[model samples]
Target: MHTVAVLAFDGISPFHLSVPTLVFGRIGAGRNNGDPGGPYEVEVCAEHPGTLRTPAGFDIQVRHGLEIFETADTIVIPSWISGTGISPELHAALHRAHARGARVAGLCLGAWAVAASGLADGRELTTHWSSADALARAYPAVRVRADTLWSDLGDVITSAGVAAALDCCLHLVRHDLGSRAATDLARALVTAPHRSGSQAQYIPVAVPDAADDDPIERAMLWARTHLGDAIDLDGWAAVALMSRRTFTRHFRERTGTSPQQWLLLQRADRARLLLETTADTVDRIATDTGFGTAVSLRHHFHRILGTSPAAHRALFRREDRVG
Candidate 1:
């Protein structure tokens, strides 16, 4: 059995901690379909063996210390306290584990700790987008990609944020086991077992108070339903009875992105859903989503999603059909 160790540090997010435990810690008795059913032995090792406080004001008791790392086949660093300095001993242990060929995982804020360990040098990485600026400033040598959900560089995997940690863990399971096993596990966990790691993080849509009210909300809903139509900025502004400039400003404030970008994203998302759930050809999906051509759809999917439309479809395609 592969031994998995999670570094339970102070101020860790409870959800971040639970992600790995739920994914790898709780191994069912069923065959991992083809992979070893020996299952992963999960141990939560902390700097000190005792109860630790979370950022949510909750407490969790950890019985093992850093010594548990000696047997770890993979070491996971969940969310970490940014300003808190890492101890020399813990650093040495992580360094030693990496030196001996143990896979290292840094989820969310935990990327800072992995970066601090000097293991991620010359490698691509990601963290919570909110901390991208700080992480870039702190570790200039590491290539910080704010666009990706996670970066899996074979041995070291870094995930973006709270929910994205699940994506990273699923990637690990898929890589360590197989796609079928990962899918079964994901079914058990009620998540997309094999979602592409490159999918964009779904930033919440924020609309201004006036826009959040009745008429503008109705207009926005209309626009969403009619993405394939010629709904330009001026057209939307007309729907809202505002000047194009005012509408653009208000829309940007509400959506945290330009109107055109948001529209494109929604259309691409729509196309993706259709490709996954329906048997539509790429060209048909393109026309349906206002992209006009399969080339345009592939271009946008690759540009925004970091993967081709066909690849995206293959990942989420219905189970009954063969890719």
Candidate 2:
């Protein structure tokens, strides 16, 4: 079984500490593109293996120590409290684990430790938007984007504030197991499903709009079910039974992106899954995803994923691939 070690500290938010535990715990059985990666064993470890007090006026017990890092396949540092520094022992252990390619993630303010540990230098990352400036100033070599929901570099990952942690963790499951597993997990958890990491962290509308409109939901479902069909913003607006201007406004407020960009991302994501799970040629996958041509597919893949379709398939579908 793959072992995941989650770090906990005194004063850690109970909710923050619970996020990883929740996501990985209930991923009962998962598969990687029809191949099982086996079940995960998630354990929480701390500097002191005992009771730790939370700001929520409660205590949580941790039984494992940082020694677990030696055997853990992944190390997750949950959202951290301000003003804490990584201890020398943890610093050395983190470096050692990273040297061996153990996946490391720092959720929300926990990114400070990952950054301070030197893993995030020269990498693009993000944190809670409120602390973005501090993180940027402290780690000038790390590119911090406060607007993004998460930044994932396969092995090293960081997520934005509190709620975005769910998205990042779900993304991890999707990358590790596959789309079906992640979607089912999301359904079981009752969380929003498959919001790409590149999506904006927060919507720009001044006041939140009622986004539960049935027509908009129906239109989005239609678009998702018909990715191969050529459709435009106007067509989507018509499907929603609204004018183009109104649809655009509502869609932006609801999804934090323009209709065209959302559609493009959906297509790219569909193409990516097909690449991982199928033996189809690039041309077939592109047409099946509404890209129309392999050239168009490659262009979007390069812009959105920083890799070509062949590279993505090789990386995702091969035996000795990234975790």
Candidate 3:
């Protein structure tokens, strides 16, 4: 079995700590009748393995130390804490692991530690967009793409944020095993299995209106159905039987964005689905999805999804053939 080691450290976020375990721990389990066993053997390791306090107000006992780095096919570094640095021993072990062609992954702020080890030199990567500037400034040689959810630069991979780490891990599973296995794992995890690393992470969940007005729920349903049309704020306000200003205020109180922006986001989401699962041409997709033109679609696609329609289609199409 392929071994994947996660480097856990003090003050590591519980969310990041859980991502790799959930992804790799179930590697060989048969989630469905047709599913194949997992190819991965995952372990959580640290510089000094033992009872380490987690940021979640809990502690975990880890048995393996940096010595596990020698046997790992992939070394995973989840998000790191601010002001935390890897010791020389840990750094040298990581370097040696990389020298043996082990894949190294730096999820979120873990990119900082990977950069410090000189593993990401001259590599194109991403971290949390909030820290992308500092990461770029500190290592000019690393080609940092601030918009990406994650990037795999051959031996080194990096993810943009905590949630994006799931995307990266799913990608690794898809790469090593197959899309079917990854999809099965995703279903078990109750998350999308193969979100592109270039997809946007800024979706705002729908919030219920505090006023508890019945019209607000109807408005949301209408917006979801009518996303394929030009949905103006005044139009939705009319549909809701409310004045535009009241609608605007209520909309934020209900959905956290103006109707216009919400409509744009809905359209962008529609366009993403089309690009992912349909063979529709970009121009036709743009018109069919209310984006009006290919250029308009391209604009929103990049602004919302952080990648072009063509690229999304290509990536998904490639994955479709992965079996």
TM-score of each: 0.62, 0.83, 0.63
Candidate 1 Cα lDDT to native: 0.77
- Candidate 3 has its poorest 10 consecutive residues by lDDT at 199-208
Clashing pairs in 1: 206-254
- For residue 111, model 2's alpha carbon misses the true position, in angstroms, by 1.0
What RMSD does model 1 have? 6.7
Q: Write candidate 2's Cα lDDT for 1-323 as tens digits.
A: 77889999988898898899889876633433334454688899998889999899889999999999999888999887653568898899999898898999999998889888888888888798888898888788888888889988877899997789999999888777666567778898899878888788887755425545567667888999989989988888999999999998888887778889999999998998898878899999999999999999999988987789998787666432443
The reply for model 1, stretches above 4 Å from the true place, is 28-37, 202-323
Predictions in order: lDDT? 0.77, 0.84, 0.79
The candidates, ranked best first by lDDT, are 2, 3, 1
When summed lDDT is taken over every stretch of 10 residues in candidate 2, the lowest stretch is 28-37
Q: After superposition, how far is residue 77 of candidate 2 from its true place, in Å?
A: 0.5
Q: Best candidate, TM-score-wise?
A: 2
lDDT of 1 by residue, 82-166 (tens): 6444789989999888888898999988898888887888887888888878887898788887776888876788998877898
The order by descending TM-score is 2, 3, 1
